[model samples]
Target: MTQQTAPCAVTERVIGIIAEVLDIPPHTITPETRVLRDLETESIDLLEFGVGLNAAFGIPVADDTVFLTSLRVHLEEARHADADPYKMMAGRYPHLSCDRVACILRTLDDGPVLSVQDIADYVLHALRAGQHEKAPSHAG
Candidate 1:
């Protein structure tokens, strides 16, 4: 029999993976949990999380530095353009909403960090882009 996993289940498993990697109690982690501010996840921790996420979801996660660099480049270009940055991001990154782009911009301008929701959104985007596949099961 084929096992179908719901998206919420996948999100929960992602949260579980984050909790395990960070050695934090699962109850304390939420969608809004900030990897840096809330969990104090450093560069190494993010690297580990990226590996874990790839292993769990069968997705290729670019190294944290590469991901951040690309994001920063986009943000930098938007900042210099006359068009609204959030709108540009929404148009450029169709998977992400304008509000999400705004949040990412705010986080970039105020602090360099990403929330759990942001990571999940990236995963979803990758999935939609045909760059990832849902895990066979949650066992991972």
Candidate 2:
């Protein structure tokens, strides 16, 4: 694929992963959809999203806090920008910086291998931690 074509394809696929994970209609999820507003995606969802992205691109971006923070920045920009969200994300996230994104695209472009459910499970675990803290206990 040409350099130009590659990003478009990757963006579409990445958004698809997000949509599928959130159980929302893929068509409704523009790249601009705020994880909080449009999708109501929780933080756990973001973590899971990261995992799916890593699997797809063939890169290890999980431990890279800098890149994860950058991805959040890009996502916020995309949500606020009045332009093509996928394109905006493509420019901000870029192929080189976001290893998780690159890994996701690679996984998609190469061949179907692993499922994203494992990653989703990880996300649930993270979400539960917060919930556990807030829940009232009756251990008397």
What is the Cα-based lDDT of residue 75 in candidate 1? 67
Model 1 worst lDDT window (10 residues):
1-10
lDDT of 1 by residue, 1-140 (tens): 11213456556777887889889888899887776777767677777878887887678886643235366677678778766777766655555667767778776766655667767766666666677665657565
- Clash totals in order: 0, 7
TM-score for predicted model 1 compared with the true structure: 0.74
Best by lDDT: 1
Task: Kindly report which residue stretches of model 2 are placed more than 4 angstroms away from their true locations once superposed.
Answer: 1-5, 62-140
Which has the greatest TM-score? 1
**Model 1 CA lDDT for position 129:** 67
What value does the lDDT take at residue 79 in candidate 1?
A: 78
lDDT of 2 by residue, 1-140 (tens): 33412545555666677887788777876544444444566667767777766555433444333123444455466677756545654554333324445553454334331233323332333333332223234479
lDDT of each: 0.68, 0.48
